[model samples]
Target: MLTAVMQCVFRILPAVWVLLACLGGASAQDYEAGFKAFQAGNYAQARGIWRPLADAGDAQAQYGLGVMYERGAGAIAADLGRAAHWYARAVGQGHPSAQNNLGLMFAQGRGVQRAPVRATKLWQSAAEAGHLMAQYNLGLAYYRGEGLERDNKTALRWFRRAARSGLPDGQYAMGQMYRLGVVVAQDNAKALAWYRRAAAQGHGKAESLAQALADDGWEAAKLDVPATGDAKVEASPVVPKQQAVGRASPDGSVRSAERSSPAGSGTTGSGQGVRADAARIWLGSLRTRAKARQHWRDMLRRFPEALRGASPSYSEVDLGDNGTFYRVLAVGYPHPEAAGRACQTLRAREPSAFCKVMAGGN
Candidate 1:
């Protein structure tokens, strides 16, 4: 995710200095100093100049403070509390970038309580104010019914707003929705159009979807993606996986990987392990009708015939022993052996994709 603000100005000079001073004088001088420090990764010096201005209620400065807190720049530890504080301060003053950051933090519970409902509100506020990232996130929240009732029509509406704003996530999502007829009538041409737009922005998911559409005999134009400049965007932290107790790796690549971790207590997964965890998280998050449908659409971009446009039978199965809380998804297939095969393939690729099978009808 991109941070709220990145530019810097002179802390000693008054705000009006830029208006009176020559372009190559005070304004340029201050900017160059800060820019050099930022380029050299001297976030401390950059912050020294920016913090006072931010504290003095400069919207851009407030935004810069939010980014610094979020990224833990200038030798600061990552503190969600500080990040939220600065973001709220900037958003309150009508900074679009700050509004977008606040919405993202609310959605992910970075420095605030996890409230998809509140996140929906913030995203709506920002989207209405014409923030592009907010528009994309708002569309996603609506599509997923996150903190709000599911309304495909409204989701499509927000998606249109985001697409018009040239947000890649919105374009990718809209393409998927159009291809599957989730909110509107199914239209391959429209789906292809949106996919192309996102692919032009170098979105990986959109590129894959576009390729899938083209494989079905639809021709789409390739886009020339521009090289991104040296703007420093705040990076999200990676979520680590917890180890399951009492599990033994009998041998092979799995055992060697397990040996790397003392009892596999943390999320430091080897290359193979990371991919497996990603697959598990993806599968685990999809349980409700809406999520399942979205999962199906995503899968279609890769395995178009996997679901055959039919809903898969899914059930919750207990995985915990001694009253511990745990559940895994059991997806039914026409052939019992097919489900078994699917489980094996996923497990081979990602060891955590195991699920206890049940009767298919349920």
Candidate 2:
């Protein structure tokens, strides 16, 4: 009888273990289904599915139920009290998302007293756990000194982290910081680089900035007057009035001019230097255009799916000639080369009409 009893107990042990496993799996499935429903905007379904599991100690379910209660879903009236209770439960369980959500409640006094310091701690906790959006929001909090001390360096560091994590807002924010030289050395090249990176990821403002930079560069290149190849290199583009400084036209033709020698005439190449400076500036602008093209190409290659067949759009183009005037040109190509060829064709028709590919253009 003892042997038989032992055998039965051994046989039932596996069954008991299987039952426990099934229950655990069912609980997980329930939480996931509820979470999905909530994400899909089905609040009633979310509440109905999550309430039981939440009561049974599923942290995710608890958080979902808390949100539902706070929002008043599934015939459940809005109850900040209940929301706070469930949120506290999840938060106590070390759920980062729950902590972040609860922190917002405290920060805004929705279900608790307003406590900025406490809220900042919770947000930082979540942010430190690699919650990307939370990292971005924490970065903003630090940037604006809301619920925390204003620290531009800390803000920039967080923003960069989020940007590297592929958050568009973070990328755009980092680009703006670089552009404005806030808490870092001002670098137009770096600013443009960040903008290009963000714009490639479909950040509208970044795209506009990158396009503007490219347009400015292209116009500057067009205005540059290349000197004569045979002219002596005077260490710079400056040429003395007596020697004559050659200028190039948009038509690729060169012209030379002469002016009276300076009053002192002691090798005063200031006039020549001014012309050379203009030429250098123009060349520098063209290089900017090249950089812009490279930026666009890099962005396109990174997200081919985003740019595929997308309409090419251009905003205000500041060529820096007279005013910020945009040279509007219609492009009918999806690929960059096609648009470039089209621009060349337009140049053939109108020498001043230069084309630069804009993001989201077909």
Candidate 3:
């Protein structure tokens, strides 16, 4: 099923690549230096710089140190205990990457007690904080009911969130969901669009599926809904932002979600007469209704003065297959540009913040 396919895709990707890609933090210079040293086979030097910074409570340094310990790199012995230790320290500081890795360790029982529930909790925390990989992992967990209730609707919501954030795994999962008619209604056009998007990013199965669709005369441009527009703000390409360390099994195989069931039922419609010219800053998307409400409450608590008279709002989008998604929007903007500027201001504190202009119909 879908879960099996996801598991296979995870197995194909190298765990080391996920770790290396997720290495990021505010200490850009130090992290870059260490990364260069490690890349050049100067493990000892890399560790030397990272250890002292890690001791000083630098999250990035702690994460680097944890990686070193986990892999036995730079003269350090492979010590899962020490790896977990540093990871925990970083996680305490709300480090997204650390949360993801620590979740993996907990899931695999590496130096820590095996607790799928705890692992899922950690993934949820990181995913809500805008960690792409954690979002995908959390979706998988919900799909498999590994540590949480079996909720394909919730799983699909999480997957859509990750896909919207431009994660290839999420895009591939969405493609699978649409292709197989798993929670949402089967829409070959949407499936092909998602597959093509993922394939463009080098996802192997997505590439194969997209090619197969093409061979059958399917065209992505024929999809009913257009893909979301690219962000106007140009983020720095070199800096990794909120990266995710994927889940791994005891045998070192990475674990991912799959899909199996047939398409379910749901309504599909467009926004009513809401002004298409208006826009809002999208804080995040949540899989559950309760969580989305809680997120709005938290946003109010965090920015009381700015949101004193304003209230957070959300739109539920139905994606056939009994799947529904809640998009948490901070509305009250005159135009898309205004919302975009407001999003930039929000990003000063919430790095994952972005703006989404509302289209006319729902």
Best candidate according to lDDT: 3
lDDT of 1 by residue, 1-362 (tens): 01001001000000000000012555446644553454334667866766675576655556655666665644755566887887788778876556666766665566798677877787677668765556655665665566798676887788776665555556677777777777578877677767766554445667677778877877543223211110111111110111111111221001111111111111122334222212221233222455445544554353322223223433332211111111223342434333433432332222222122233442
lDDT of model 3 at position 49: 76
lDDT preference between candidates 2 and 3, better one: 3
Residue 308 CA displacement from its true place in model 1, Å? 51
How does each model score on lDDT?
0.46, 0.47, 0.60
lDDT of 1 at 77: 57
**Model 3 poorest ten-residue lDDT run:** 259-268
TM-score, cand. 3 vs. native: 0.59
Whole-model alpha-carbon lDDT for candidate 1: 0.46
Clashing pairs in 1: none
Ranking by TM-score: 3, 1, 2
Cα lDDT tens digits for candidate 2, 1-362: 42222112110000000000012577877766765464334667767887888787887677666656665644557787788888789878776656666666665566689776887787788778765545665776676576777887898898887666555456667666765677878666565656655454334667787677666662211212221111111111110011112222333222332221111111112333232112100001112333434434543454232233333223343323212322222323433333333332222222222123343322
lDDT leaderboard ranking: 3, 2, 1
